[model samples]
Target: MALVAFSAVIPLMTVVNYSVQDIFGPGQRYFIGVDWFREALRDPEVHGAFLRQLAFSGIVLAIEIPLGVAVALLLPKAGWKSSLAIVILALPLLIPFNVVGTIWQVYARPEIGFLGRVLNDIGIDFNYTGDAVSAWATIVLMDVWHWTPLVALLAFAGLRSIPDAYYQAARIDGAGRLAVFRFIELPKMKSVLTIAVLLRFMDSFMIYTEPFVVTGGGPGSATTFLSIRLVNMAVGQFDLGPAAAFSLMYFLVILLISYVFYTILQRASAS
Candidate 1:
């Protein structure tokens, strides 16, 4: 109880306090009601960040969920090979977020990084730092590389949980691969896939460290998602009241969307 309060509750309360008041300096503050919230809602920068965040999260979920499932399906079902594959797939998830960013940053360098050098040599005109499209692509690819393993591992667990009886039944029915997957595998994997989708959505929605380290929200604000924008407001500009309000709204958005996802998935599973 005390630990939760100190770590989460207290900080949240502090943000709530700051959200309604204008702080000028030490001990110089005044209550401003909902002015900051209204301003945040009206801010074009916030709007852009919000939209970008949505797009990024949507893209990530679309790519990772399907790709992860395919990878899980393709994995060897057993033996030493299965163990080795699992270990290899788990490697990316074990890497620290900032370290992943740094690695990609160097690895995508046009002159020295292997990826960048190959692309440039192939005449793709790729430069993550100098091009907005390339920047977005790099960030998305980086995210996919770093996080897809999680979804794959989850789906793999879901796959492994199916009983031999189910496969035997499918075989007796003379079911095609697609029919078996649709009728048996997918239905069986729903619970874990639901978890994978929710986890990926929430994490991608709140992502900051890796993208920030890689792009710094550069190339003319092309990748300035909500987290980056909020940090810029609070830390860069020292707009505590507005930043606090923004953060509250941010929290609410995540909560609301996650609830919607859970409800939809629950209803689907039930049906």
Candidate 2:
């Protein structure tokens, strides 16, 4: 209540105020209703950043979800090996997001870095700092390595929750591994997978720090997702009105997408 109001509602009202005003100083401001939004909506560079954000989220979900599910499926059922596997798989998630980016940044340097040197040794020109394609690949790979463990851990929990009776029934039916996965495991995993998708989608959509730290949203503006663009506008350029409007629009987009996912999740659960 009070906490929410102070933290979220108050700040939002301030943004709404800023969105409708051109502010220069503490007391220097003028009302310009809806103008900032119009400018933000019409900006070509903003559109490009939004599209890049969507693409990044799409790629992350495509790779991480399937890889996570497969890894979860292959994990040991029990015993010391299972415990060790869990520990190892969870290691990446333990690293701070910023530090993860720094680690990858160092590892991807074309000179002394292991990944960079291996690629160059193999006659491949891989330079994340200076090449757009390499930059994109490195960032995407970094995200996959960092976040896929989260998805896998969630899926593993879902898999572990199923009753032994279900497996026994599948065995009695002579169900093959694929058939068991599709008919039994898949359906049970659906709820958790839906959650994984939503979490990944929202997080990836707002992704900034790692990519910024690694490539600084560069090799040009090639990796500048919406968050990076928003930061550049709000903080870098000091455009309060436009930045406020953009932030509101950004909040709406996330809300809308999450709502859509929630609708689908509910319907799936109902069916």
Candidate 3:
């Protein structure tokens, strides 16, 4: 409790304090009530970033969840081969976030990077730094590469938990592969899948580092999601009051959507 208070609660209170004040350096601040919040609500940059964030998170979930499950299904059931595959899948996740960004940034370079050079050579005109669509695609692909292993591992654990008796029963009943998966595996993996979805949604929604490093939140404001917008306001522009207000709103948005996700998934699982 003390650690939580010191780590989260105290900093949160400080943000709360800043959110309502118009600060002019140390000891020159004035109370401004809800002015900053009103400004944040009215900001068009905030609106665009929010929409982009939703789209990114939605696309990520749509791709990674199904792909991860598919990968888990394809993995060797039990062997040294399975161990090797697991280690290989997990390697991407072990890389630091900033390093992941740096790697992709270099890897997507138009002149030098293998992916970029190959695409251009094929006459595809794929420059992530110059094109909005390409930038979005790269960010999404980068996230999938970095994080899908996590989902695959979770699904694999769920798969391993199913009893041999269940498989034997399905086999004796002459259930086909698809039917076994649909009736038994899907139901059994529901809880873990729920967790996977929530984790992916939250992480993807708040993503900043990779996109920032790769696209720097643009060719324009094209790749600018909410987190990037917040950072620009807080650090780039140094608008402390509005930034603080925006941060609080950001926290609420994530918390609210997460609760909604959890509740819906729980009800679906229960039914």
Q: Cα-based RMSD of the predictions, in order?
A: 1.2, 1.0, 1.3
Residue-wise C-alpha lDDT for candidate 3, range 35-93, written one tens digit per residue: 99999989999999999999999999999999999999999999999999999999999
Name the runs in model 3 displaced over 4 angstroms. 265-271
lDDT of each: 0.94, 0.94, 0.95
Residue 85 lDDT (model 1): 100
The alpha-carbon lDDT assigned to residue 104 of candidate 1 equals 92
> Model 2, 69-96: lDDT tens per residue?
9999999988999999999999999999
Per-residue lDDT of 31 in model 3? 94
Q: Summing lDDT over every window of 10 consecutive residues in candidate 1, give the lowest-scoring window.
A: 211-220
For residue 4, model 3's alpha carbon misses the true position, in angstroms, by 3.0
lDDT of 1 by residue, 34-138 (tens): 999999999999999999999999999999999999999999999999999999999999999999999999999899999999999999998988898899899
* Order of models, best lDDT first: 3, 2, 1
Pick the winner on TM-score between candidates 2 and 3: 2
Clashes of each: 0, 0, 0
Cα misplacement distance, residue 261 of candidate 2 (Å): 0.6
TM-score against truth, every candidate? 0.97, 0.97, 0.96
TM-score of 1: 0.97
